[model samples]
Target: MLNPQWLRSFAALIEQGSFTRCAEYLDLTQAAVSQHVQKLEERLGPLLIRRPRQLELTPAGHALLEYCEEVSAADQRLNKRLSEHDDKHGEISLICPGSIGLALYPMLLNLQQTNPGLIVRQRFAPDKEVLEGVLENRFELGLATLKPDDPRLLVSRFTEEPLELIAPVSERVEGWEDLKRIGFIDHPDGRAMSSRLLSRYFPEAPGIGSLPCHGFTNQIGLILEPVARGLGFTVLPRSARLAFQRPESIQVIEGPRLVEDTLWLIHRAEWPLSTRAKLVVKTLKAQIEGLSLRNHACRRA
Candidate 1:
């Protein structure tokens, strides 16, 4: 078994991604940090730290972090329970991706309006990194769009965001092949999502050269501005269209079957959820379920 003290140092190192920074922040010598990690490896019977160019966590290191987070959460709950003599009010930390943050954050703030005792800490991350932060005890909850089939993650289906291929109606495009002519626009993460989306449609893994596109932009919001200005067509979540503030800026291609991103509310299954966390989860479920495609624009905003 790894010592809790050692686990603390390990998590700190992993978060900082290096021993020197971890040692400096934790007020421990670099040698001492390295020793703690070596001793931990001795207990684990294998190298958990990959100390090549940068501080990379070996697969074992990742597994240990997950275990440490569970223990840490349990310890926190115990501390809270023992101090139950105090007031019931406490803070709830949350991490979410772009779409949900813009949409649900306001409603969540309103939940605490009548009861000012509740505290909330919100953090924004992309879809994939949000889950990693949650599993590592960085946040109590994460709102994400993609969910892997991991039993250790408890996921609640909160919202279904419709995906659409939006284009300037003046572009004189009608169907999928028109995209071939205009060259599909790329968002910041579109290279990755586009590969995933294409693989789902063509499982044979067609060569990228066979169906090539032009120009990649790292910003999703920027991609839309160009598209509205007659640059090129792009695929985006329907909720994002609310930014136009006018009907003619874009047109949504309907019924041709674009990718659908189902948003899930994710939290570690092993962590003991607090009362505030549970209440927020329930309220989010109720609110998202009550919202239909029409109300999606409202929720995203």
Candidate 2:
């Protein structure tokens, strides 16, 4: 009998490209991931994986990948259908940007409180990682600022949040000179967003080279702190502003209002979402809509 556990490890290894990364993604030891692949090879003949320079799946390994994916998809579908009749709601896993997750977490908590049977797990990941997580069945759904080009993933507009250039309350930003003097606090999406905003708003400076960055942080929540302490300015979405604990410490710098960033909900096109997962998605959509409306009202007021 084929072990689903081993197949899962193999699939992760294939997607992640390295046993170490696959093990990290799957929360398994490196030795364990290797062992799982070895077991599969033992059962279904040699599944040679090229190593040393780079890892490449052998012909057998590639063939096994298709079978494993199909089997996993079928199993998930069957399990989803079976669980519909059960009294308890199954788990729902989601990956989203820190900003979106911060804004939507309250609604999720309220949902779990009302429906005790449902359990929701949310993790903050970069846009790229979120897309990969949903594609690999590691997450049921994902929210991201950027959509992947892959046709296999279904993308839908979630909501648009206003982006603002923020600086310490003490600093003043008027033109290129002021911006260059203040510097920038780089975050995960900072470079891309900053570049686009600069190109549109500040025509004088062509690229990011004109505005130097003092430091960088992968953690979105922490990105604002440095700015608050008068370190450097950063551009962030409205949701991020709402999530920031001390908004009073920083001020929105007066500048050209660039286009807002649209957050997208993404999932694998082929995979069927479980009933509980579907419910979570619905809740998230409604909450996001309400948030957009509120943001609009705030802007008008």
Candidate 3:
């Protein structure tokens, strides 16, 4: 490998137009600058034409100068990218369950709007897919209902999302019998969430599968549509229920037992999060906390 100092001296000699001037610019002795040129020629050969009162470049010298220019350009680009990476700017990729995505997507968009430099990329996925995305390096952050036990992950409790039993405003639900009469509007997590909440509230009630299926939808935004139209009842996370467009059309069934699902925030433990991703995580946590407080206040009222 050629020495970088020698290349620097050679380039500087050409730019300064003389050995004496190159030595002055580089804070080196004239003998040192000349020696650099000598070493370079010994390694590559015939780099310059020593003309009195003028300096001229050989073909080899021209090639080396071009290589030096390319290296300089690449260095500049690397520095620019590093600067952007350290700032609160650039893309932040995250994957989360559909329920949280419904609530968090709008908040993420609002954050991007305020910051202008941030580009948010969010995906709606199940817990399995969320974990996979983070582990595979497709996402910088992930939110899951279950805490991952993988040692490769760094997990923390982000927030708790309550599971709400919802039915049309016109429907009256007083007991398990009422739910059975209405039938079940099932979604991807309908059975799981219903099982958890119903088992706690009505210990005598059968499993969620016992209820006749009224309708089904996998879309988080549309999960409450059938319930809102008085078709049936369903259980969902509070975030999903709140994101429904026609909130007045449906009601959350109040019960003695309250069930909440713990949401976990996850990222790879091997690599630290970028500045933009850390900012996004911090902003999301703050917003969700504020929203949770507001909901608590409303429930108390």
Candidate 4:
């Protein structure tokens, strides 16, 4: 491989039009410049034709010069981009579970609206997909309900969302019998969430599979639609429940024990987050905290 210093010297020699002038420009002795050119020729062969008045470039020299120019230009562009990298701009690619996405997507859009230069690309996925996307570099950030065990991931608790048992406003949920009678509106996470919350509050309740499936929808936004229409009850994170279109139509059944899922934020452990990503993370945390506070206040009232 040709040394970059040799290439720099060669480019300078051509630009300055003399070995002496090039050496002066580069703050090196003329011998050093000559040696640089000699080494380059040894690696790449016949780069320059010596002449009495002026040095002329051979075909190989011309090619090397062009390559040097391209390298220099690319270096300049990279430097400029790095210098300009700040919290206000750039793209943040993130993948997260659908429940958080339901609440976070709109807030991220609002952040983009306020910072026009910041571009947000968000995907709704399950915990497995979220972990995979981050590990594969498909996304710069990820949010998952389960903490990944992979050593390549840098994980931190972002927030905890309470899992709520939601039913049509008219349904009175008193115990296990009430949920069985109301039936179950199952989504992708409906069974798992129901099992965790139910087993804590209603220890005698049979496994979630025994409940009659009143409806099923994979779309997070529409998961609560059945419950809102008085079709059945379902379990969901507070974020999803808050994002439902008809919040007044469904009620969060107060249980003796509160169940919450900890949302973990993950990224590549080897790479530091860009300024723009840090900004996005900060904004997301603030918004999620506010949501939690508001929900808690409402529950207290």
Q: What CA RMSD would candidate 2 show? A: 11.7
Give the runs in model 3 whose Cα sits over 4 Å from its true position. Answer: 1-85
Instruction: Give the whole-model CA lDDT for all candidates, comma-separated.
Output: 0.70, 0.83, 0.90, 0.89
**Cα misplacement distance, residue 264 of candidate 3 (Å):** 0.4
Q: RMSD of candidate 4 to the true fold?
A: 8.6
Candidate 1 vs candidate 2, TM-score winner: 2
In the range 29-68, model 4's lDDT, one tens digit per residue, is: 9999999999988888999997876999999999999999
lDDT of 2 by residue, 1-301 (tens): 7888999999998888888899999999999999999999998877765677467777888899999889989988788668954434767688998877888888888888888877779899988889889888888889888867789888888877677888898898887788788889998889887876677777767678767888799897899999999899888887787889998899986566646888888888886666677777787888888878887788679
lDDT of 4: 0.89
Clashing pairs in 2: none
Clashing residue pairs, backbone N/CA/C < 3 A, model 3:
none
Better candidate by lDDT, 1 or 2 = 2
Task: Report the poorest 10 consecutive residues by lDDT, candidate 1.
Answer: 201-210
- Better structure of 3 and 4 per TM-score: 3
Give lDDT for model 2.
Answer: 0.83
TM-score winner, 1 or 3: 3
In candidate 2, stretches whose alpha carbon ends up further than 4 angstroms from where it belongs are: 1-81, 84-88
Estimate, for each residue in 1-301, the C-alpha lDDT of model 3 and write its tens digit.
7788988899899999999999999999999999999999998889999899788999999998898778778977687457645545677789999998988999889888988877789999989999999999888899999898999999999999999999999999999889989989999888889999999988887788888999999988998999989999999999998889899999999988789999999999997878777788889899999999999999999
- Clash pairs for candidate 1: 103-300, 188-218
RMSD to native, candidate 1:
12.4
lDDT winner between 2 and 3, please give it. 3
**Order the candidates by lDDT, highest first — what do you get?**
3, 4, 2, 1
